[model samples]
Target: MPNLLDIELLRTFLTITETGSFTRAAEEVHRTQSAVSMQMKKLEEMIGRPLFERGARSVTLTPDGFRLLDYAQRIVSLSEEAAAVFSEPELQGQVTLGVPDDYADRLLPRVLQAFARSHPHVELVVRCEGSSSLGERIEKGELDLAIVTKCDVGEGEVIRREALNFVGAREHATHLADPLPLAAGPQTCSWRRSAQHALESVGRKYRVAYTSSSAAPLISAVLAGLAITILPESAVRPEMRVLTERDGYPALPPCDIGFLRARHARSAIHDALAHHIVTRIGNLSPAVLADAAE
Candidate 1:
């Protein structure tokens, strides 16, 4: 008989590859790092090849690992689709979801509340993090679904994408001698990266005055005049000064917002929730674009 490959182990492998950190992968799967490591070892032995190259503080998928990723994603997606078609009765299952911190504050609460009201028996677990982190969690099956900025969606399916804009203090002058002082999130934030690149593309020098993964701290930094930051228009408050013109400063390029669902585990609750977010966000797009135009 051919060597058997466990679907669960493959799912774990995919998570480890996407996160590039065993520790984070373990956290996503709700397993200890050691256990995750052991599962990988078992998987490698069963396959007769190492899937990832291990280092002291980092990990990367080997060619074999990359090859497995495509299959893993497909298998997981098919499994979910099968469950969706065959499962009976109303959807009732635990759904672990990931959302970017900024969206969590401005948009997610309403979506979750609505979902809870509609699916009263479903348990909802939410994790708020940067887009990159959320992507990793979603890939690993740690999250049943995710709302995040567009980044590496991997070979997994994409549900929807929205454009993001740069938002700053309304009263701040556009002309600055130094690199624009920026209040931003950690390095993994897509908005922060977009802001820096936009400035650099225009030959503008900018410094990060504040960096925090949390939206509250980043927004506080912006409000305190420590620095201006890029944010989605939906996240901007009416009280703050905003720059809508592109005269002195670089034009903030649009970033994509993506909603994703795990291919492997199909949950009707997650599908419904994803649909809800896409619909709500679509309804808000015109306003978001209008704000950016200002």
Candidate 2:
């Protein structure tokens, strides 16, 4: 018989990838660092290949480890699903999820209505904030899961991609302003970074004309023609106008939306909610997107 891969070990392995270090992984798994090391060594011996490329303070997947990633995720997810079917435990617990304010108005209602209908017993707590702040909260285990805008220095499961656009109010000439006036979230925003880079690439001048941590206020400034701003395609209101290459604005990078799970929290409710989110929010299918827009 072929040797069976231990689900617990794979679970630990996934934790390490999310947390970025053995020390943090051990903390998440409630194991000592040495025990985590031994588990990896044993797994290596079983598989006849090394899984991690060790850094001074972090661990990245080796090529072999990357090969195992999809398999591990599927195996673990299926195992949990199978267990839930047999055990049939009522998913009754409080789960805290974070959502970036930039998307809250447009995306939250659909996600909430679907989840609440199916799992009424589960108490859901939501924190609305900037993606950068939410990402930090997720890493520190303050949030059970968080939706974030993908950035280079962070890691998450990218679930959706949409074009990030240069947007101004319709019938406004804000995009053509000299040292273009821009409205955006605070300095930490990824969209702000993309806007700056795109402008710099084409030798365009711009200044931060307004800054707000909340999307509502930022949109208000744009609609008032105070400044132009960046927004995901799905988030752009009908009243807003998109700036295109024909308008002399350089194209912006595509925005990636993804989720991060808390390294330490594993529960049926969490998995169920994650599944709901992926099914409902992942692709933005035509029907789902249309309904969500309503």
Candidate 3:
């Protein structure tokens, strides 16, 4: 029989790639540097190719490593899914989840889908609002859980920090307008605040030409060349163009996205849901995994 690839080795490989250093990866995996080194050696032997371009201070993925990464992630996800199917009992209860308007179309589906698969009996009630409003709801004990974005220091477990970008339509020149047109959400939105502050800091003139609380209208505004909006890097679509420093858009600070649990928690069901959410979403990316783990 051929040598089988190990899931642990794959995880370590991903950690190393994400952290950009073997030392950090070792810390993440709770292993010594030498042990991590040996695991990579064995993984390379199993694949019969060099996975990393080892350097004095850092290591980078070789083409073979890059190719294998996708497969490894899929395999690990499937393995975890299979284990979870039998290991976790069918749970029953209601969970009220709050998310920002921007992430409803992107992050919510994955979280709800994973919960549905493992805890079919649990009822999920979802509410969409701005991050600040969502945090308030969590504090008021109206929501069981929330994923919120914060401008400065965020509360709760930060899963990732995504850079903000000025996005415009792919073929549109709306960003070229004098006193650059901006499409923004409500005044309370952190992203909007960050965008305005960044422009002010750079002495750039901008006006809120379009305003919408929902993503569709904002996207439409950008597509029609009416205005450009600030969005997290992950939210940038192929139909959109990301305007950088060269495009005269000032660099905006990264947004801290985190999971906030209600202060007055209730049952085991909520705990299970929280654990499931953290694990499943954490696995989505290396950066998220590292942060969620911490």
Root-mean-square deviation of each candidate, in angstroms? 16.2, 12.1, 5.1
lDDT of 2: 0.80
Candidate lDDT values, in order: 0.67, 0.80, 0.79
Q: Residues 1-294, candidate 2, lDDT per residue (tens digit)? A: 767999999888777665666777788999998998899888888788998766544456777887776677667766765675557756788999999877777877767876776677899999998887888898888999888887732788888789999999996878778989999877778888888998999999999989998888889989998899999987999999999999889998898888889987688788888886775566521111110000
Candidate 3 lDDT, 38-86, residue by residue in tens: 9989999999999877655445677888888878866776677668779
lDDT of 1 by residue, 175-235 (tens): 3427677888778666777778877777878888889877888777667666777776668
RMSD of 1: 16.2
- Which residue runs of candidate 2 sit more than 4 Å off their true CA positions? 1-89, 284-294
Candidate 1 clashing pairs, residues 3+ apart or interchain: 76-263, 76-264, 77-263, 169-241, 170-241, 170-242, 179-205, 179-206, 180-206, 244-294
What candidate 3 gets wrong by more than 4 Å, as runs, is 1-4, 11-38, 48-74, 283-294
What is the overall TM-score of model 1 with all chains considered together? 0.59
TM-score of 3: 0.76
Scored by TM-score, the top model is 3
For each candidate, what TM-score against the reference?
0.59, 0.65, 0.76
Best by lDDT: 2
lDDT of 1 at 67: 74
The best-first sequence of candidates by lDDT reads 2, 3, 1
